[model samples]
Target: MNPVRATTSTTGALVRTGAIATVAASAATMAVAAVGHAAGISLDMSGAPIPVTGFGVLTAAFSLIGVVIAALLARFAERPRRTFVRTTVVLTVLSLVPDVIADAGAATRALLMLTHLVAAAIVIPAVARRLAA
Candidate 1:
């Protein structure tokens, strides 16, 4: 195969993997949120309840952002897998800052953090698998 076509194929595969991962992570996060709610963990924050769908929506959005980061790293980084893993891990940890300081109760805050971790755990590995080592 020609170099340009091969590059395009790889990029396409990366996007496909990212899309699947995004859906999986979003669903998983939403499910976690629902389970937490059922277990009497309030989803309330700042005097408002966070809808379970919100979890999936936000997860999908952020997971797409991660996909973009992975694509960029694949194109420019010397070792795409290593850089993607390191960068995303830092980002995942940073994402919990808001949850940690939110006005919600401890259980709610912990649930939010758990959803973030769940999404990250699903998306990071799936996308990273498509990157060059």
Candidate 2:
């Protein structure tokens, strides 16, 4: 296989995988939020309760950002899979900072963090798999 053609193929696969992962992560996060809400965990922040759809919206947005990051790493990194996993894991952990300190109650904060983890768990590995080792 020509190197350029191989690279293009890999990039195309990465995009496809990332897009599917984003949708899955978004839906998974939304389901998590809905379950939490049903179980009486408040999705409230500040003074307002977060709608269930907000989870899907935010997850899709951020997961798409993660996809972009993976694409960039695939293009530039010598070990794109390792770098993407490391970078996204750190980012996923860092993403919980706001949830920990939000004005919401403990349960709500925990629920928020859980949703973040769920989305990251769904997206990071999927995108990483498509990256060069």
Candidate 3:
């Protein structure tokens, strides 16, 4: 196979893996958040009601963003696994900034951060591994 064809095939496989991982991570995050909500851990985002649907939507969206980043890195980065993992770690840290600054109570902020970490935990490694493969 030509170099371009090989690269495209690899990138495609990476993207498919990323998509599956994204969905699983999102579902897991939603389940945890639901349990927290039932236990009186409010997920109020600065007084705005964050319904379950909203949670799923946001999770899926952000997870897809990670997938896209992974795909790009797989296609172009000199060292795809290292570059993608490092970029995602930096982005994950930046993502917590809003939660820290939000006017919501401490528990809510903490829960939000946890969700972010959970999603990152599932996505970052899966994508990086695929990229490396």
Q: Return the TM-score for each candidate structure.
A: 0.98, 0.95, 0.93
lDDT of 1 at 129: 93
> How would you encode candidate 1's per-residue C-alpha lDDT over 44-92 as one tens digit per residue?
9999999999999999999999999988998899999999999999999
- Candidate order, TM-score descending: 1, 2, 3
Off by over 4 Å in 2: none
Give the per-residue lDDT digits (tens) of candidate 2, residues 14-97. 989989998998899989999999999988899898999999999999998988898899999999999999999999999999
The candidate that achieves the highest TM-score relative to the unseen native structure: 1
- lDDT (0 to 1) per candidate: 0.95, 0.92, 0.85
Q: Report the lDDT tens digits of candidate 3 across residue range 8-73.
A: 898888889888988888888888789889989987876886776666678789989888888888
Q: Candidate 3: where are CA atoms >4 Å away? A: none
What lDDT would candidate 1 get against the real structure?
0.95
Candidate 2 lDDT score at position 58: 95
